[model samples]
Target: MKTADPPRPRTRPKRPGAPGAHRRRALPYLLIAPTMLALSAVLGYPLVKLVLLSFQDMTRKELFAGTDPPWVGFKQYRSIFTDAFFWEVVGRTALFTVVCVGLTMGVAMGVALLMRQVDPWVRVTMAGVLVAVWAMPIMVAAAVFRWLTDTDYGVVNWALGLLPGADFTGHNWFANPWHGFTVIVLVVVWGAVPFATITLHAALTQVPAELEEAARVDGARGWQLFRCVTFPVIKPAFVMVTALMAIWDFGVFNQIWLMRGGQPEKEYYLLGVYSFTESFAVNRYSSGAAIAVITVLLLLVGAVVYLRQLLRMGEVE
Candidate 1:
C-alpha cells in the first residue's frame, strides 16, 4: 500500500518564463502601436476635424475668438449647390479630367509601342529623357513652362514667329482663359506622360512574345496585332493608369495655381483651387470644407463606377 501511494503524477517541464507560462499575444500589436499612433496624429485627426468643421459655421472671428463654432447644418452645402459658379467649376473640372486623362493615356500607349519597336540604344535614350522629364519638380516645371509661354521673349513665341505668315509674338497665353487652360493641359500632360509610358512599357514587357507571333502568323499586323494580341494582355494595366490619371488630373491645384494663380477671371479654377481660395482667401472655412467634402465624394463616386465597369469588362475578357 505504501509503494502504490508513492506513484505520484508527473510534472510538466518548465517553459522559458515559468512552468506552463504563455507568451504575450499582444506583443505584435505593441510593436505596431507607435506607427498607428503616428498615422492617427497626422492623417486621421485632420480628417475628423475637417468633417466636423464642415458642419459648423467657421468664420474668421469664430476661428480666432476661441468660442464654440456655430453649427450650420446643410446651409453651407445648400449655398454651394445652388451657386452657378460652383456648377460651372464642376463642369470645367469634369471636362478637364476627361480630356487630360484621354490624351495622356493615348500618347503613353503610342510611346510604349515605340519603345517596344526601337533599338536598344534608342530605347535607353528615350527612357533617360522620360525619366529626366518625370524627375522635374512640379514647381520647377511650372516656372519653366511660364518662361516658355511668356508673351515677350518665350521660345514658343519665337518658334511660332518662324511660321510662314504667322506671328504669335507678344500674344499673351495667360490673358485668354481658354489659352491658359490649354497651356496647363499641355504642362500636365508632359509631366504625366512619363509615368503612363513607363507603366505601360513595363506591362508590355510582361506579355508573352509567342502570343504576338501567333497573331502575326494569322495575318495580324500593326494595329490589328495590337488590338487582338497586345491589348487584352495589357488592358488591366491600361485601365489602372487611366483611372490614376483621372484622379491626379481632377485634384491638380499647384500646377494651375503656379501657372497664373487661377487668373483670367478665375475661369481656370478647378475644385482644388476653388476650395483653397474659399478657405484661405475668403476665410469661409465651413464652406470650403463642404466644397472639399463634396469634391471628395464626387471623385469617390466616379472612381467606384469607373473601376466597377473596368473590372466587369476585364472579367468578360
Candidate 2:
C-alpha cells in the first residue's frame, strides 16, 4: 500500500517525429535519393515529353521550324488505331515475339540440361563459348548473320547446297517474308540463347540434388523428373527470363533493319521499327510517338508480370 502510493510516473511513448525516430525512418529513402533523382532526370523527363509529344501533331515541318506543334489530343492515336497496316504490324510483331520466345526458352532449357549432364571439361568449354557469344556486339552479330544469309556465296547457302537434294545457292532469304522471318528468327535465337542458357544453367545449379534423387527413387525420370522437381525449382527464373525475352523480341529492330539494308519492308516492321520509320523515315513524328507509347503500354504488361514474380520470390524467401 505504501509503495502503491508512490507509484512511478507513466513512461512516455517515443514521438513519431522525434529526431532519431525520424532519421531512422528516413535512412532508406536518404540512401536511395540519389538513384531516384538520377532516374527521374534521365528517364522521367523523356517519358513525360514522349507522352506530350504523342498528343501533338508534330511533323518534320514543326521539327525543322523549331516550333511547338499544335496539340491534337489523341488524333495521332486514333489514326494509328484505325490503320489496318498498324494492326498487321501488331499481329506480325506478336507472332514473331511468341515464336522467338518459344524457341529461345526451349533451346535454353535444353542447353542448360545438357550443361548439367556433360563432363566438367565439356561444360566449361560450352560455358566459355556461351560467354563469348553473349559478349559479342549486336552489330557484329547482325553483320555476321547478314553475311551468312546473303543471297550469294553465303556459307549457310553453301552448306545447305551440299545436301543431296537441297539447293540454297543464290537463295534470297528475304524475298519471301516467311523465309525472311525464319532467318531473322534464327539470328534472334542465336543471339538470345547464350544469355538464357547461362541464366538457366545458374538456376539449375541451385536445384537440390537430393530432391532430384528422391524423385528418381520414386521412379520419376526424364520429363517426370523435370516437370515434378527440376522445373518447379527453376520456374521462377524461367518465368523472369521468358518475360524479358518476350519484351525484347517484341521490340526487335536492329536485326531486321540491318538485315534488310536499312530499309525493312512493311512486312518486316515490328513495333519498334514501325515507330522509327513513321517518325524519321516518313516525318510522322507524333504518330510515331503514339505508336511508341502503345508499344510501351504493351510492354508494361510483361514488366508487371516480371515485377510480380520478383515480389513473390521475395515473399517466399
Candidate 3:
C-alpha cells in the first residue's frame, strides 16, 4: 500500500515550449517599441497637431465677433489658389530647386568619380574638404556668402578691383532677383555637394571591379568600359542623390531667408520667405501652413519618383 501511494506521486517533465515561446513573442515587440516611439514623436505628433490646427479658428477677429471656428469648407485653400504672390513664389521656387539640384548632382558625381581613381590619402583629404563645406551650418553659409558678395568691401568687389578693365566695383550681387537667386543656388550647391559625393562614391565602389576587368579583357577601354560597366551600376545612386537634392532645395528656407529676400522687400520674395513673413510678421498662420504643406507635397513627389526609379533599377539589375 505504501509503494502504491509513492507511485502516485510521479512528476511530469516541464514543457520546453512555454517559457521560450513567451520570450520569442516578447522579443519582436521589444525591438519594435523603440522605432514606434521615435516615429510617434517625429511624425505622429506634428501630424495630429497640424490636423487640429487646420480645423481650428485660430483667429482673434473671430473670437471678438463671437464666433468659433466654423467649418468654412476649404476657404483657406481657395484663398491660397487665388493669391498672385503664391504663384509667383511657386514659379521662382521651382526654378531655384531645378537649378540647384542639377548643378549639385552633376558636379558632385564628377568629383566623386575623380576621387575614386586617386590614392586613398588623396581620397580622404578630398572628402575632408568637401565634408567641411557641407558640415557648415546653413545659416553660417548664407552669412559668409552675403559678406563675400556685398557691393562694397566684399571679396567680389575686391576681386573686381584686381581684374583688368572690369567695372564690377559697386554692383551688389543681390541687387537683382536673378543675381540673388544665382547666389542662393551657389550656396545650396556647395552645401549639397557632400551628400551627393558621398552617396556616389559609395555607389561607385559597389561597381564590380571584376566586371570592369571583363570588359577590359574584351578590349573595352576608357569611356567604353565606363559606359558598359560602371555607369549602369551607379545610375540609380545618381537618381537618388538628384531627387533628394531637388526636394531639399524646394523646401529651402535658410538660403533664401539669409539672402534677405523680402528686404527692400516683397517683390523679390519667394515662397519660403513669403510664408514666414505671413505667419509671424502678419499673423497669417493658416496661409503659412498652407504654403508649407505645398512644399511638403513637392518633396513627397520627389521622394516617390526616386523610390520608383530605385525599384525599376533593381528590376533591371
Candidate 4:
C-alpha cells in the first residue's frame, strides 16, 4: 500500500536546457577556434590581401599612399596570358622540375636498392653522407656548386678535360643560357637526391626479406626481383618523393637565380624568379600577386595529380 502511494506521484525526467544543447553544439567550434585563429593570422590574412590585390589594377603609387585601390578585374590575368615572358617562365619551370625530379628519384632508388645488399654500417655511413648533404643550407650548397662549376677553375670542367676534343671546360655556365640551365638542374638534382634516398631507404627497410627471397626462389634475377616484388612495395614512397621533389624543383629560385647571377635570359627566367623580380625588383604588386596565384594553382594541380597516382593503387595489402 505504501509503495503504491509513492508511485502515484511519478513524473518524467527533465531534459537538458537550451544552453546545454548550445554548449554541446559549440564544442566543435571550440576545438577549431585555435586553428581558425592561427589561419587568419598567418594564411588567411595574406590570402585575402592577395586576392584583393589580384582583382585590382593598382600601381605601387596607389598601394603605398593608402588611396582607394582601383579595380580592373582580370586585367593582370589577361596580361599574364599575353606575356611571352610568362610562357617562357612556365616552360622553364616545368622542364627544370621534370628533369631534376626524374634524375634525383631514379638515382636515389637505384642507389638505395644497391645499398640494400651492403652491410648495416655501410648503409648507415651512406645515409650519413646523404643526411649531411641535406642538412647543408640551400644557399651554401648553391655556392659550393657555383665554385665547382666555375668557368675558369671548375672541377667539373677539369674532369671533362680527360676527353679529347672536348671543350666543356672554360665554358661560361652563367654566360650561356643552356649551360646555365644545365648546371642549375644538376645542382637541383644534387640537392633533391638526399630526400629521395632517405625516403626510399626507409621504405626499402619495410619491404620483407621473404618477398625478395620468394622472388629469388622463383629463379628471379635482380631486375626480376625488383619488378615482381620490390617495386610494388615502394611505389607509394616513389610517388610521394617525386611529387615533393617536383614542387621543390618548381619553386627553386635561390639556386638557379644565384647560379645565373640573376640573368634575364631564357634559361634563368623560371617562374619563381620571375615572380620575385616582379614583386620585389619591379614593384609590380598586382603582377607579382597574380604570378603567385598562378604558381599556387599549378602546385595544387601537380599535388592533386601526384596524390591521385598514389590513391589509384588503393589497399595494396
**CA lDDT of every candidate:** 0.90, 0.93, 0.79, 0.84
lDDT of each residue in 1-317, candidate 1, tens digit only: 45556766898677668633444556678899999999999988897888888899999898789888999898999999999999999999999999899899999999999999999999999999999999999999999999999999899999999999998979999888888899999999999999999999999999999999988898999988888889998988988899899999999998998998444257888999998989998899899999999998888987997789788987897
Per-residue alpha-carbon lDDT of candidate 3 for residues 101-192, written as tens digits (9 for 90 to 100):
88888898789889999999999999899889888998889889889988877888788777888877888877787887788889889899
TM-score of 1: 0.86
Give TM-scores for every candidate, taking all chains together and pairing residue i with residue i. 0.86, 0.90, 0.82, 0.85
Reference-based lDDT, residue 203, model 4: 95
**Worst lDDT 10-window in candidate 2:** 1-10
At residue 236, candidate 1 shows an lDDT of 87
Between the candidate structures 2 and 4, which one is better when assessed by lDDT? Answer: 2
RMSD of each: 6.7, 3.6, 6.3, 5.3
The lDDT leader among the candidates is 2
**All candidates in order of TM-score, best leading:** 2, 1, 4, 3
In model 3, the Cα lDDT at residue 282 comes to 77
Better lDDT candidate (2, 3): 2
Error of 3 at 301 (Å): 2.0
Question: What is the lDDT, from 0 to 100, of the residue 94 in candidate 1?
Answer: 93
- Clash statistics: count for each candidate: 0, 0, 1, 0
Q: How would you encode candidate 4's per-residue C-alpha lDDT over 205-306 as one tens digit per residue? A: 999999888888889987777888898988888888888988888888888777766665545777888888887788887888889889988999999998
Give per-residue CA lDDT, model 2, range 100-127, as digits (tens).
9999999999999999999999999999
- Candidate 2 residue pairs in clash (backbone atoms < 3 Å): none
lDDT score at residue 251, model 4, on the 0-100 scale: 88
User: What RMSD does model 2 have?
Assistant: 3.6
